[model samples]
Target chain A: DVKVTQSSRYLVKRTGEKVFLECVQDMDHENMFWYRQDPGLGLRLIYFSYDVKMKEKGDIPEGYSVSREKKERFSLILESASTNQTSMYLCASSLQGALDTQYFGPGTRLTVL
Target chain B: TQLLEQSPQFLSIQEGENLTVYCNSSSVFSSLQWYRQEPGEGPVLLVTVVTGGEVKKLKRLTFQFGDARKDSSLHITAAQPGDTGLYLCAGPSNTGKLIFGQGTTLQVKP
Candidate 1:
């Protein structure tokens, strides 16, 4: 079975603090993604990595950056967390195909106070 | 930009009731996927439709892709409380990234 695990299931951070969300997949997928889900807004892509050291900005990438130093790990970094950055962050991974199934982690609910 | 629009943002039904959710798009897609998300969990892939005018069934759930490959629908028969969750539809963009709909939150009461 494919397993995607996040570093944290919940997090609390103060404003202007640096935050990091980590995701690891055991399926050896080549594609990984980060997204923030909000009520009525659905899942909006923040960043994605197709390969090691390769990254692309999604629809809403502001204030966020990604690192893919290895194939199994992807990290999302917030330069300086703000209250508006509080959201449920999800990480997903898929095989190297446009139509492949994306397996997602349980998600991390970040609270920026 | 490729976009997926899901209809009926919310639905509340009793057990044994039938319901359908629709996902529409103006842009053509090579494939579409449906996902079900329970509270506090990430969305899980339920089904994927590739060919136009295709229908697939999984237990009591049925999925249909439009002939134009621009739309899809999910229908549930005799929904139960276990079926309560958020249903999402997604399609791949030209960049290989997925564009997701807002989702339909279905609440089934026992």
Candidate 2:
């Protein structure tokens, strides 16, 4: 089975504090993505990395950034956490092709206070 | 903007009942996928439909891709409590970016 793991299942952060969420996939996938899930807004992509050291901005990337130092690990960073950023953050990985199925991590529910 | 609209944002039904969920989009996609997410867990791929008109089945679940390649449907036959979860429909945009629908929350009662 394809396994994707997130650093934290839940987290609390204060305003202006930097937050980092980590993700690791064991499938040796070449593509990784970060998404935030909101109540009515659904899941919005924050950022995606196609390969090591290569990243692209998604539809909603204003407040978030991603790092892919290795093929197995991807990290999402919130420069300065705010209450508006409190949501469930998800990490997903897929093969190099567009049609490849994306495997997702359990998710990190962050609460920005 | 490319968007997928899923109908019946919420569903509640008794065990042994059947249900169908729809996902429609004005934009075309190369492929459409269905996922099921349980509480506190990430979404899991249920099926992927590539052809404009295609049908795939997984046990008690059936999936169909619209002939126009802009829509899809998921039907569950004799839903069990284990089938309760959030159902999501997603498609790839022209740039190969994944676009997701709002999702449907299904609750099957025993």
Candidate 3:
């Protein structure tokens, strides 16, 4: 089984605070992604990286940014946390070629106070 | 924008019953994927269908891609308690990103 590990299972933060979420994959996959899952909106893509230091915006990338300084680690940053940002965040990684299947981490549930 | 719409947002049936979930889209896709997610966990990919009109089976679960590449379906024969989860369908986006459906939540009672 492929393992994608997220640093935090649950998190809480105050409004206007800067928050960071970390993810690591052991499989050395070339593709990494960050997404926020909501009740009716499903999973909206925030950002994705194809390689280290390479990033692209997804459908909903207004308030988020991503970093991939290392091959195995990907980080998501929130410039300013707000109440509406409270949701489950997921991290996923995939192989480099031919759009291989993506493996996902457990997810981090964030609560902005 | 291209979109994948999943039908039957919620379903509950007996353990022995069978059910089918639909994933429909108006635009053609190069490939389609099905995933099952448990509460508080990320989605696990079940199958990926690339050929139009392709059919793949895994134990009691079956997946079929539409002939036009615009739709797909998942049919579970004789579901069990372990079949309970959120079913999601996704397709490749123009920028190599993935677009996921709203998902179908299934509950199988024993």
- For lDDT, the strongest prediction is 1
DockQ of each: 0.77, 0.73, 0.67
Report how far off residue B80 is in candidate 1 (Å). 0.9
Across residues B1-109, which tens digit of lDDT does each residue of candidate 1 receive? 7889998999999999999999999999999999999998899999999999999999999999999999999999999999999999999998877889999999999
Q: For each candidate, give the interface RMSD after superposing the true interface residues on Cα.
A: 1.2, 1.2, 1.8
- Candidate 3 chain B: worst 10 consecutive residues by lDDT? B90-99
TM-score of each: 0.97, 0.97, 0.97
Give one digit per residue, the lDDT tens place, for model 3 in A12-102: 9999999999999999788999989997677898988889999888788988888999989999999999899999999999997325788
List residue ranges in candidate 2 displaced over 4 A: none
lDDT per residue (tens digit) for residues A67-92 in model 1: 99999999999999999999999999
What is candidate 2's TM-score against the reference? 0.97
B94: Cα error in model 1, Å: 2.7
Model 1 CA RMSD to the hidden true structure, in angstroms: 1.0
- For residues A4-111, what per-residue lDDT tens digits would candidate 2 score against the true structure? 999999999999999999999999999999999986566888999989999999999998888999999999999999999999999999997544799999999999
Give the TM-score comparing model 3 with the true structure, all chains together: 0.97
